[model samples]
Target: MSERDDEEREFDLKWADGAEQKEPSARARMLAARWKENPPGPVPFRADPEHVGSRRRSSWVSTAVVLGCVAAVIVLLGYINFRAPY
Candidate 1:
């Protein structure tokens, strides 16, 4: 309101809270255009020979671990229920 108040506040009210948006950079716009022109195809399976072996090994190991955990839980529950005087 006063001359001192104007000096204390220099910010404009036009874009006080709104963000200043900007267009994408040249490289980003070029990549977007290229992607639209040549969209990617469906991903291929077993693309690498090294990955194929590890992937198969991991599945087998995971299955064995899951089965072992389930068996242990069932055995523990059965032992606990049998020993309990109900």
Candidate 2:
């Protein structure tokens, strides 16, 4: 929720001092009010371009390392199969 929305929200409401803490009903009412005021939706997130680019580069390097290891295993198995003594 944004700052303006926060201001409009009614929270920690008190009917009387030392009242029973039946907060479930109050929470639902507050949620209903906020829903009517501002419907729920996904919050937009924007990452810094430089940070994203750096992460992408690191991911690519890791992928290449994994593929290289897989390729080495396959080559070793092929050589072993060809030279195995029955």
Candidate 3:
């Protein structure tokens, strides 16, 4: 085999065994052990109570505006169709 081929083969073999002989570092092993001892629980949602009333009021106002706009458009279209020369 060529010299370059031999060098590539040596590199591949070195990495293959180098990885197998490795273990997790001290910090990683400690974290894994601690996680096993006390795992985390699901997070809870938190909302501010002071702004809840204002938020609800704004939502209702926005809904009323949207419905009013839709009603106006429907009436305008009906009038246009009725007055059209067909």
Q: How many residue pairs clash in each candidate?
A: 0, 0, 0
lDDT of predicted model 1: 0.84
The residue-by-residue lDDT of candidate 1 on 1-86, one tens digit each, is: 69777765544434453558857889999989998999877887647787889989999999999999999999999999999997
Look at candidate 1 and give me any clashing residue pairs. none
C-alpha lDDT (0 to 100) for residue 32 of candidate 2: 92
| Best candidate (score: TM-score) | 1
TM-score for all models, in order of appearance: 0.49, 0.46, 0.47
- Tens digit of per-residue lDDT, candidate 3, span 7-78: 999999898778856788899899899989997787658667877889999999999999999999999999
Error of 1 at 46 (Å): 4.9
- Angstrom error of the Cα, residue 16, model 2: value is 24
User: Which candidate, 2 or 3, would have the higher TM-score against the true structure?
Assistant: 3
Q: Please, what are the lDDT tens digits per residue for candidate 2 over residues 1-86?
A: 68766655534233343466645588899999999999999765988677899999999999999999999999999999999997
Report the number of backbone clashes for model 3: 0
lDDT of model 3 at position 36: 98
True-structure Cα RMSD, model 1: 10.5
